[model samples]
Target: MDLVQLDIKGISYSQTQTGAYALLLSEIGGSRQLPIVIGAFEAQSIAIALEKDIKPPRPLTHDLFKTFSDSFDITIQKVIIHKLVDGIFYASLICKKGKNEKTIDARTSDAIALALRFKAPIFTYKNILDKAGIQLKTSTSSSQTQSPKSKVETEIKSSFDLKSLSLKDLNKLLEDAVQNEEYEKATQIRDEISKRS
Candidate 1:
């Protein structure tokens, strides 16, 4: 099947699932959108990469892996959202090491995060998009169906640091974070929980 390229257009909290985030993938040549629900940690990983914030004291696992690949002179060409099975999205990383091309199975979240960090294109099997993407009645209608200034976009820009908030406030903040696609705040909250335990 042919692959259709996609870009990460927006993310939001999943109304259908508690404590999960919905990632929206926008097709490059179409108005269809594919939404995948991912956990908070993965959401944060992708968000941090997207925001281009590299100030963490230690490298994140994905960062470490990317560093390792770079050190070995491996190049990530692109990432592919290859399949959707039983409502789950599947992805792969396309890498080039010397004269050989390698494909690695990857969680969709991880693949997307790496693709952003590597400045690589993301492709999805056309079938997957057809199966999972929400089709609109018209391209113009879909374009105006949601604006860039939607609630998620607004919240992403105004999110607060989770470490500075109390547990009670964190709960409320989580709601806002999900709405705004502030995965960094959500990740910080998860870390705070681990630290308190």
Candidate 2:
């Protein structure tokens, strides 16, 4: 099976699942997208990397893994979103250690968290995309719309819009949201902070 390359076009909070986030993968030169729900911490890690924020005092877990990989002279060649079983996505990391290449099975969230930190390409089997991806059906079917991509983009954009609130206000809102266990709101606030930086 051919591995169809995908890029992390965006990440957004999952409206249907509390404390979970939707990571959007856009097919290279194609109009299809795969949405995988991930945990909040993983989502924050990916968002921080994507936003290129370095203001944090302590490195996140993904950053620690990247540091470890660099220290060992290992390179992450790519990540493959290999399968979807019972509504869960599976992934693996392709790594190069010296002259040998190895694949390690990983949870999709951790794989993507590491992939974003390593700046590696992500791929998926064509059949997996066909099975898990919901194609956008447009009238006449001449040009299909990428509905998932647009939805994810819109959610992220809204979450990161600085004009939506003052920093002090957002911080206060974040504190209250976190206290209430409103992780979705907290993730949005975290995204807002990373976006601001």
Candidate 3:
């Protein structure tokens, strides 16, 4: 089967599942989006990778993996979302070490995070996209529209008492949340910092 390239659209908290996040991947040059549910930690890792400005004080697990791979001269060529079984997506990393190439099995979430760090392309089979892709409704007005997930994220952003915390406290909390693998919380803190600056 032919493969279709995908781009990371965004990540949002899953309304149907507590502590899970919806990772949206849009087909390149297409309106259809594939939503994969991932754990909170993975969601945070992916978000951090996407945000070029927000850097954790310490290296995240994904960051560490990238550094280790670079040290060993391993380059991630691409990531393929190969299988979907019982609502779970399976992915593999296409890595190259000089003339040698290897495929490594990885969870879809982890594969995507590493792919971003490696600047590798992401792809999925057309069959899989047809099975799981959602078409977004185009709006006719000039006013910007938001997804339900985006609305929820906005609500979360406004609910936090970020004004009460000092910049030093917020940074400390951000670091602690990342260290504790509380990505959602870390995101809110990061947003607060972004707003302040």
Candidate 4:
């Protein structure tokens, strides 16, 4: 599968879920964004990495891993959000030591945190992005229908857990999204609805 580069846009505190934050990964040169819900601890670690001036009193777990890798001459080449299952994202860290390279399995959150610390780039399969990412604007796509957004683009929080909602509720959301001209959101709800039936 083709790989799409990603950059951390920001971390958002989930309005509907306690102690849960959304890690927003924006496609490097596109309007699509993938939001993955993460825990508070992982969120804190990623936030700290993004803010260069804010150093912790001591090295956090991710920081310790960075230190250990440096001592062993290991290089974190990049991070890849390799898979998504049941709304959970799976990732891998591409690491290199001397002439040897290895891909280590990791949680999507931790992989992103490490990527930031190492200044490594993040990537995901194009298909995964298509399945999970929300388009932030209308753009020419690869033979796919493009949703038009008005000039005043408001950020829309995606329906994170469609499986949790009853089919009736899912139908309601789909109707609302279509009425609101939220084609991207509607597309997601439609997919979930299709999965059930």
Which digits, one per residue and each the tens of the lDDT, describe model 4 over residues 28-135? 989777777789999999999999999999999999999999999999999999998766789999999999999999999999999999999999999988877665
Model 4: which residue pairs collide?
none
Clashes of each: 0, 0, 0, 0
lDDT of 2 by residue, 5-103 (tens): 988867776764778887777789886667676889998888888887454589888889999999999989999998876667889999999999999
Question: Candidate 3: which stretches are off by over 4 Å?
Answer: 139-197
lDDT on C-alpha atoms for all candidate structures: 0.72, 0.73, 0.80, 0.80
TM-score, one value per model: 0.68, 0.69, 0.70, 0.75
| TM-score order of candidates, top first | 4, 3, 2, 1
| Candidate 1 TM-score to native | 0.68
Global fold similarity of model 4 (TM-score): 0.75
lDDT of 3 by residue, 16-40 (tens): 4589886878899998767777899
Global lDDT of model 4 = 0.80
Model 1 alpha-carbon miss at residue 80, Å: 1.0
> Which candidate leads the pack in TM-score?
4
Candidate 2 residues lying further than 4 Å off, grouped into runs, are 137-197
Q: Whole-model lDDT for model 1 versus the true structure?
A: 0.72
Worst 10 residues of 3 by lDDT: 147-156
Candidate 2: residue pairs that collide: none
